[model samples]
Target: MRPTFHLKTLVVAVAAFSVASIASAAGLDRSGQDITTFLQDGLYAEAVYTYIDADVTGNDNAYIGGDNNAYIQGNKTGDVAESYDFFRYGVKADINDTFSVGILYDEPFGAAASYSGDNNFVARGDLDATINAASDGALPNYAQAEGQFDALQQAVADGATLTPQQQAQFQALGSALAIAQAEQATKGEGTNVEVRSESITAILGMKLGENKNFQVYGGPVAQRVRADVKLRGIAYGPATGYTSHISPDQDYGWLAGMSYSKPEIALKAALTYRSEIDHKMQIAEIYPVAEALGINPVQSNTMEMSTPKSVNIDFQTGINPTTIATAKVRWVPWSDFEIVPPLYNEVSKGSYGPDGLALVGYDDDQWQVELGMAKRLTPALALSGTVGWDSGAGDPTTSLGPIDGYYSAGLGAKYNVTENWAVSAGGKYLWFGDAKGQLPTKKIVGDFQDNDGYILGVKLSYQAQQNFN
Candidate 1:
């Protein structure tokens, strides 16, 4: 029979060329042709996405009334956080059509890990025995002025050993070491868990008109911040505790944009701006059980924080030839954020007195609004959807953390095959709104609430061909 049907048609063409070479080495047709050129170029290449999607959700609340016999008698609750996701993969090349360059390994920023340990607005144990009997009635006049400056520094190291009642007790221990160094320069240095931050950003884009759709670039942006501060709670028996582990501050900012197109009704518009990079962090203020129970010797502070400044405006139109629609807006001023740290101006100029001032001073700000739509059920299939709205900034300062205010929804899909491969998938959902605050001082008590989160993303791509002539 015709040589057994030509060896079964060469074993079905070598099993369809081994499943198209394992779907082009598993990058699924270059992430489905970069999600069909990012939904037909209407997603305004969110800062040039070779493939990136991020997510995070967080919330917090607190309430305590002034001295109604020190209120906050339980029933205060908050917390439901826990949602963060990130996935990135980028690449751009054209090195010759008036120049081009790209590299955007994403994960721009992330953080969302709940907290509410055994609720009931924590702060019980008889309120630490009534704040240790009001801090031992305000530490016996600052420990009798630190025992008259330790008996005049042990009588000047035992020199001038004469006595007229120890020179009136060394002038009352130099008037109690000048009032305990002026009340330790205004009571500075006290922390016990509060709001914190986590971050990540990578950018690289370069291009200039004449066929690359106008461009300007910038690079080098790195950040990693973590803070858990808490002050005033163990009253007079166990308070000092502030854990911060920071060391990831690499700055150098830049980013500029411009785009306009009209491939015959496949209109497009873009505007990008990313600038604001400042991180002089170097914190390692640990107190791991007060340094494994030997107490004090874990200090490292170097602060100067900044991560705010973003502006994006994208617009796209092409309601035919495969459908497309997009509109985006973003503006972040994060209330001109501030986290001074260098002893926040020497604890507000009193050198660490007045309890070392600065319990947390934030001025935050934010804004966002996006809408998207895409469809192309042919030459390789495609689909997309997006919705966003985030607005709410600063007003909750109990260490000013928890940052609530959001409402986002997303979904994406793509699957190109030839013309340089492609494949992609995305997901997002954030709806957090409900945060109250009041705890900058007044001896901590309780009231805080927050909840909502979900996000998932993926992408892949590949393009090769450009032998300029």
Candidate 2:
């Protein structure tokens, strides 16, 4: 007779490895958009917190001010990747043998990075010299202009009547001086970028087939997104001193999936697909150099954007009464994603043609895979390990997060606090792949090599299985 394996015996083993360890990836992927909580047996609820710290350093190309084609080694860029953290919450319950519902919330996409130190990414230059150069010697230096403006202001205060032509000249000088002063204050500042988004999904699942072995689920997803970006210093060449802010916007999308399960051996598999979400956002942009091209330097507009769609496959099966194996695969077409702020796109049109260029974009799609194993050592204790790999969007990617992909190893443990409550902790070490950082114009600006990072996460969960006869 064959040995009978009980699904309940390995519940702890599977839960131990359920904590996600992926906090960063290509094209702003975060939280992994996981929906596994809904697949758990019985009533399930979990809250997970994850933190990511990355050490990403490199050298800016030595062509900041000279020939753009030069690729000489330059100053060290320091650690530009900042530390980030977020939270995820999920709750699922069965209404009956044939119906179920779940609600999940997570930060689905984001990025944070800042550049500093004595690098080309940091702004540096004499205010007067920059003004003279940008104007091709047509505009007076800051000192000269300040002196004339001060004299005119004193004369006006002394009740001296001025001609309309003189008044116009004085107003122009004042505006020019103000712009120069503002730009001067930015000296020594570095480039920085931060993007954040949140998503909540409500799902309804229906059981099908004999013994209810197959299930299908669909849901409506609500997502909110916002971002801020700054490009300073010569590393950006003609694009320096550019800034943009995307106000928070909320949009809706949809998700659909199907799953199959064999309770006897604890076998389960799910394939999920998420639709793209479109957002109409209010964006404000400031291009310090726009005046040189005869266009207004400040602009505010309502722009349209769409986040990419994705697909994920999750699989797990019992290896024995005490162990379970798991595998996950994910795909995202990042190359289709782009952020083209109005002012930035308009400025680039002078060089990149009518369509212009995107302020942020990718060159390829992304694929991620992971395999893992979990074992229940005691009735209340379980341990798990996983190995993962990510195929980044492409090399010569954005300078903000200059990594191609990564290889990772993770370890996790879970302790049952009681029959209905448990806590899980996991950590993953990542070895990042080397990549060349490029601007939107396809100009290489930095080379990052041998970079690495780590992810840490904790999950608090509750589960209560219901038995039906």
Candidate 3:
């Protein structure tokens, strides 16, 4: 004998546990890029707020010069992971028994981190010290030729003629001196990075099958992205004193998915794919080393960036008349994503050949999975619990966010304010994996271990069903 599920009660079971998973998973994933609102059996709307705080601490590599054998753990890095928060809103309506429309908004991908204290990540010493450290004692050579270099520079300014050889020497000396001065000016500052983005998706769905049990949906997505980065101190060596600002840019992409549901046993499953968005954005960069490579140290230009494509699978089934089980799986090809600023790429051509390198990149894709259960304890109250894991982009990742992945457990509860309104709250604790931080040059620069963090979220939602038969 099969136990029949009351549609109203089953709706509560399916929606009760959604708050517990997908926050701070991996590779800049936030809000899980969820679309569950459109899968509900009735008109549904929700607003959610989530906050996350992480304690990421480790040791900076003392050997900033990049010799592996001579490398030693340096000073404590303090906590680099900053607290982050965001909001999400979703609304869905069934236009008819065979059609539906929905809109979803969320902050999908982002990062925030700051480094302080006596570490390689922070600049140290006075002007002279900074100059000497940055120039590898080459400051003395410049000091020796200060008189000649100055005379040649002033002569050029005054339209004086010189031999081509003299002109070459003069330019080389000036660029070296300028880079040292730039380094000295930034002395005593710490490293920091911040990235933010927002997305909105509009979707339309049409039902299929004899019982109208299956649905296919497609949508257009609008996304906005911006970021700022500053790399200071000896930890970055020649690349120290580098900064980039990516102005906000909006672009469009697409989303497609299919879902199946059976109200009798409260069974539902959805598989969704989101296409990558390409953004052409204004960028400003200040690279101290650029001058030394015969390129201007300051530049403002346009760069093209692609966020990354992803896929998600969400499933839920009834365990009993009052209990439901759920599972979520997500994949992102982070390895295919990277940021390469123009001036930085041009400067790198002197050493890495024509291919150059990206300012940020990952070596592997990310995979995340979470399993959970929800139980309706009363007609108006429900509780949920979940356990999750994420395969980080990779170990030896960029130092900006030096974490590999995480193991997490979460708890949530929902209370119905009325038959159609409800409030839910959830919290998750994460145990982060150990990682060795590296520079874009493939130099191991830091070691982070035994780190952890937490996430908290609250949501208010409304749902109303209509009889279509």
Candidate 4:
């Protein structure tokens, strides 16, 4: 007799691709929070690894400038974002018939990008376009090295002999000129960036009644966030030399959910809610060398970063002897989430603010929906397919994250290696939505359209039966 699972493994394959991530969703939501670690039966441990390749493209334009002219005519900013590699693991243990415990680890949110290359928007010395311009097209007063030289000549002529005081003043002026010129020399060289976060959760489950049809679970969640950023281009203005690094911080949240399942028919329905995690980050800010001209050069800044609140509903049931149907709906309050350090607010010119506008925050929440089905073709093999849609956090978003939303499709295959082990492979493709990257002046920086993302993943699971019955 062939060892057979038939339709028993349908839900497992479908659940793997039910998540939306990469450049597909809103905010920094990278994993889609698909908690499959605790969805299996018996004493189980599982590991999954994923790789994502994605990019965004569009024309650069300012939303606020008069005539609404384009900022970058032909060159696109995000050709291919930094590739992302992620890993997740979970283990579950059942202690008797009424109590079970599980622990899970995953990346909840992240972002990575680089804006370097030849383009009119990011050429070296490009910042001087605005910095060197005179008021109303008139020659600026002592704007260049030539002007500084002329001023130094005038000072020498006025001095009767070389006094020590006058010599000291001349040295200071010379130093200031050197600093000013060097500041703009490599303005476009270091424009890379990265932001990352991870989470760990411990869960407690209790069985209600005797049949074990109802299970209630709750857990405490902990997450860590770290980021480094550097900005340039004419859009940044005096903020062009702005660079920031956020020291990592760990914070806590909570999750609660309930599930009703009938194993005989391979039916399961779960609703889970995860609370928002808040972190107060300590930051080190460095500025355009000119900022050194200020009274204080190095400053410490603190910003409050709240992850987001989310709800997920998942359902799966055997459609036939060999097939199972699965679906999911997820909601996240992305509009309420933001990252704005106090220093960014103090330096950000125009309408950008910590209270009203943001360094990077959405104008609305996000909603994601997906539908899929899985079928067992042979006792050792199963196949699954899924389609999904995400209503992005907002439209006309910030350059930091300029995606409106996406439509996605996926495929997966699972092969049972033995009675206690299985290996699964899966891949998903996303068709990203459109958005206009904005400046504080409400100018459109980039019109990102026709973007895409590709993700590949694999999973391994082991089940060990320990019956104390």
Whole-model lDDT per candidate: 0.43, 0.86, 0.85, 0.69
Candidate 3 vs candidate 4: the lDDT winner is 3
| TM-score to native of every candidate shown | 0.30, 0.88, 0.91, 0.84
Ranking 1 against 2 by TM-score, winner: 2
Q: State the displacement of the C-alpha of residue 198, model 3, in Å, after optimal TM-score superposition.
A: 0.5
Model 3 off-target regions past 4 Å?
64-70, 125-180
Which 10 consecutive positions of candidate 3 have the poorest summed lDDT? Answer: 125-134
lDDT of 1 by residue, 1-469 (tens): 1111221111111111101110000000111111112212211122223222212222222222224124333432344233333344445555555445554444344333233443322233333232223333333444554565576667678885637886665554443333233223223333234233333333334445556555454445453445444332222122223335556656555556655655455555767776776777776654322322234436677877666667766666666556666766666665565454453233233323554444444445566665777666665666677777666554343322344455767767666565445555556566655444434343433333444454555445554456566
Look at candidate 2 and give me any clashing residue pairs.
Answer: none
Ranking by lDDT: 2, 3, 4, 1
Per-residue alpha-carbon lDDT of candidate 2 for residues 97-170, written as tens digits (9 for 90 to 100): 99999999999999999998888778775567444433335564778777877888888999998789878767
Clashes per candidate (backbone, < 3 Å)? 41, 0, 0, 6
RMSD of each: 17.1, 6.2, 3.7, 6.4
Judging by TM-score against the true structure, name the best candidate. Answer: 3
Compose the digit string of candidate 4's lDDT tens values, residues 324-373.
88888889998888777666656453224445445677787889987888
For candidate 3, write residues 1-469 as lDDT tens digits: 9998776775665666666578754677777898998888788999988899999999987652326434578889999999999998999999989999999999999999999888878766344444444444555444645566788978989999989999876765655565556656687788999999999999999999999899999999999999999988766766778999999999999999999999898899999999999999999999987876668889999999999999999999888888899999999999999999988888777668997878889999999999999989899988999999999999889998899989999999899999999999999999999988888888888999999999998889999986777
